[model samples]
Target: MDATVNACIGSDRLFDSPTTMNASVAIESEMKWISGMRPILSEEDFFTWMSLIIYVTLFVALIGIISNLLVIITCARIGFSETINISYLALGIADLMASATRFYGSIFLLFEITTTKVHFDPRTVSSVVAFLPSQGFEKTAAFITAFIALERCLCVQFPLHVKTIVTKRKTIFSNVIIYIFAFGPSNLIHMVYRFKWVYNATQNRTVLAIDQSETRLRYILARALYAYYGTILNFTALIVVWICTVYLVLGLKRKAVARKENFKTSFIKDNKQKDLQVIKTVFLLAVTYLVCSIPTAITLLVPQFVPEFGSTRALARISRVSYMISGLMMQVNSCTNFFIFLYMGSRFRKALITLFKRH
Candidate 1:
């Protein structure tokens, strides 16, 4: 969602200075719509569909966030003193943040959809309430996953070195650095662009705009930073994880071969199961990240080539639908991490079970 909002707002063609247009005609036309456009909920059956989906998404996001928070808290309190486990705790916190942000952000979006008046400045509110939080949580999750991969790599490649260097303090410090790096650019962009109202002739509503050249520059820079650097970094880490997982699986296979040769019958059987479980978990995480993120990434690049597509009604509708679908995918990203933990991680599943038992 961070990437989507930035892409939408950063498009120079999307919002030109309304002040350049005839303000008098714009104001009169906007007022006419305000006076005439009645609420369609009474007449429209589709309102029910919209309402149902919004409510369901909100409920799922809320529950997912709460469940993740409980997992993080429980793990913090009860997890063993392993630096590797600390990474899972950080991941839970990041997932919870993403889920909570999506839930509240979706409420605002639902209001925007249903209301006659544009309630809030989309640029500013979206920057703070939607973009910044999304970027923060996403980057945090990415870094935490990368750190987990690195830890696993170290453990597999140099067990003695991992035992000596992977400390709790180190993990905490790394988490702090990841958050600062992840959130810094988006927050800075929000501060620079402070949202303002602009009269939108097409929509006949007071919509939000950046409204200044300097702010536009900042928005573009921030969007570019995330699109190129942050996303690339995430993809790189994902590749590293895949490679490391494969390496680990191969190593386990070699060990099984040796154990079989030595006639250690049980040694190959039990540990192979554990190795398979870990492989499945890592593969799921990788696939989930790719599926959730690719659409948003493509959306970020859409504006650059939109002129090539031209301005047809069908094209406009397609673009709008794509944007909505991409936004939904982001919400799925926030909610699905918990399910991944439930299915893949024994520790997370145990923690969740304990949490439910207590409640």
Candidate 2:
């Protein structure tokens, strides 16, 4: 999560300490040494503790990648022709890409801390490698989730019109638009605003400067733009998905009740049961997304308002650990859609079985 790096940056600004870079490098070297040979019991065994965290994060990310990939292949093999099926396939691919990005970020961080001597710098290393790709994929996943939720809500609320409205071509078009928006101009702005190497005349060298602007106000504005991109857009989509899920559930219940009372409903008749099943599946997906995302959002948002949260060493350490846990949860959410499909979508489960049997 960018929250981790952002928190560090925020902390650096608040302290206004010239030794911040040196302190960071010393900490990194100490951590590497601790993870290697000597075990330091001071400062709550920070290095040893963080090493455990890195290993655990790596394991979970690998599992996530494999699970998302399997879902993609299964969906493609079994569900090539249906519109909703194709959407699920697209969502699965998006999930796979997301997991891959996260997995790469995790490996890169480990490599930097374990192998590379240079201190971890968010400006140059994180921005280019982890920050942009992860955000792109995360936004893509969020938008596609909202897309699926909206499609299901419409199909349940107005079944007949939905078929005409949400054709294969239109669905594909919507996905392309999502991809474009997820990786478009705002992200380019982020790449430009994040970092630069500025000459320090006093130090007689170039130092990596992040979020530097001509004016403090402009710097704040730049950070706000990135923050909104990272948190707000995704949260808005989550809220929409939640609302759509609720409407869909109520609609499904009403129809089920009407059918029980022998009252015929004037809507699409052929796929009520199937549509209900899909609604159930999407409902689970929405809930999972909310559960996993809210923690990360909180982690990112709170520190912005309470800069003091990361001002102290102890607090910063705690924030780092919290960031890792929340990050893992987000990754799990991205990968576990496959399990949700297996649980709620009987068709998906049967398809998986058939796919394996064929092989």
- The Cα error of candidate 1 at residue 89, in Å, is 1.2
What's each prediction's TM-score? 0.68, 0.74
Clashes of 1: 0
Each model's lDDT comes to 0.56, 0.62
Q: What are the per-residue Cα lDDT tens digits for candidate 1 across 95-197?
A: 7887787677666546544443464544335445564466567666766766676666565566448667888898888988877776565455545455677
Encode model 2's per-residue lDDT on 1-359: one tens digit a residue: 22233223222221121101112322333233432333223344544555576577668768878888878888877755667777787777777776776676666555534533333443344444454456566667778888888888887777669879888999999988887877553355444455657664333566565544446654565456455555667667768877887887788877777545543454544355566677788888888887887777776677779764444443545555556566677777778898988888777788789888998
**Residue pairs that clash (backbone atoms under 3 angstroms), model 1:** none
> What lDDT score goes with residue 122 in model 2?
33
Regions of model 2 farther than 4 Å from truth:
1-42, 115-123, 185-225, 261-270
lDDT of 1 at 294: 73
TM-score of 1: 0.68
